[model samples]
Target: LEGLAGELGIADRVSWLGFRRDVPELLAAADLFALASEEEAFPTALLEAMAARRPLIATRVGGVEEIVTPGTGRLVAAGDVEGLVAALSALVSDPESARRQAAAARARVEREFSTAAWLGRLDALYLDALGQRAQAPRVAAGERPA
Candidate 1:
């Protein structure tokens, strides 16, 4: 809120934009992402931001640390305003660095969590489980497979 309003100098331009229908497109068009969270499970927001290839400026908590590594974005200590400010400043001062990080983040997602790769791995797991079940022999009332 304050960060967005003050940093961007658009206090009045900040609209709620609640439940936007084209969030994906907006994220894709974004230059950077800033998330301040203390706890999270999967932090799908970070994943979504990464999927959109935007450099993140997130607090070092939850799954954010995993998402914003050296190659992805700047991870600041939780509740560290100075750190956040520094990161924001550095990124703002050097857009090239942010662009590189964003590209690397997208590449990382493509390598680790791409939909095609995820589905292929799931298929392999199912096949392996099925094969194991098939190879196992049924047991009689008082006897088991040797």
Candidate 2:
């Protein structure tokens, strides 16, 4: 990150805090959250940003598309710098629209990714797995199960 900052001639423009315990507070103080991962699986940072009610700009990769809808945030193709720039520009140019989108993102997170919702989904998945195992035909010792 330091190298990149120097290369971009914006060393003064960036502050790289290695690890932070106050992530929620930091997120809440931000105007926007941008995630440019090339690939990701259910990113908790994205969810945190959503929960923080910040407008988001994320690359369309992995579960990001499923989480960031049109009304909630902007989605750009992975590795598309121009698209990312446009997304940021749009949000910066339209504060009211950005706020509206931020609100929707927060609502979506609260409605679908809340602790109760996650726990309920996990319980359902475990139940389904157990049910499937129970329905499997019993096999004799030393015999292969079909």
Candidate 3:
């Protein structure tokens, strides 16, 4: 990352804070949050950004689309530099829209990704799995469980 920053002539503009414990504080202080991952699976960083009510710009890969909806954030195709640039530029130019999106992002996180929501979903999944197990036909005593 430092090498890339130097190549892009942004070394002075960027700070490389490796593995800090104050992630929430950092996100809270940001005007926007961007995740340029080529691939991801429901990244926790994205959720943390949403929880912090920061406007989000993320790649449309894996479960990202499920989190970053139209009013919540901007999603670009993975590796699409132009799309990412456009999203960031738009947010920078329109603070009202950005703030609205940030609020929406935070609301979505609270609605769908909160601790209570997660626990409820987990409990439901466990119950459904247990019910399915009970409904499955029993194998003979000498057979392996299937």
Whole-model Cα lDDT per candidate? 0.83, 0.93, 0.94
What's the best-to-worst order under lDDT?
3, 2, 1
Q: Candidate 2 on 47-88: residue-level lDDT in tens? A: 899999999999999998889987999999998999999999
Which regions of candidate 3 fall more than 4 Å away from where they truly are?
126-146
lDDT of 1: 0.83
Cα error, residue 36 of model 2, in Å, equals 1.3
| RMSD to the hidden true structure, all candidates | 3.5, 3.0, 3.0
TM per model? 0.79, 0.82, 0.83
Candidate 2 clash pair list: none
- lDDT for 103 in candidate 1 is 89
lDDT of 3 at 76: 94
In model 1, the worst 10-residue window by lDDT is: 62-71
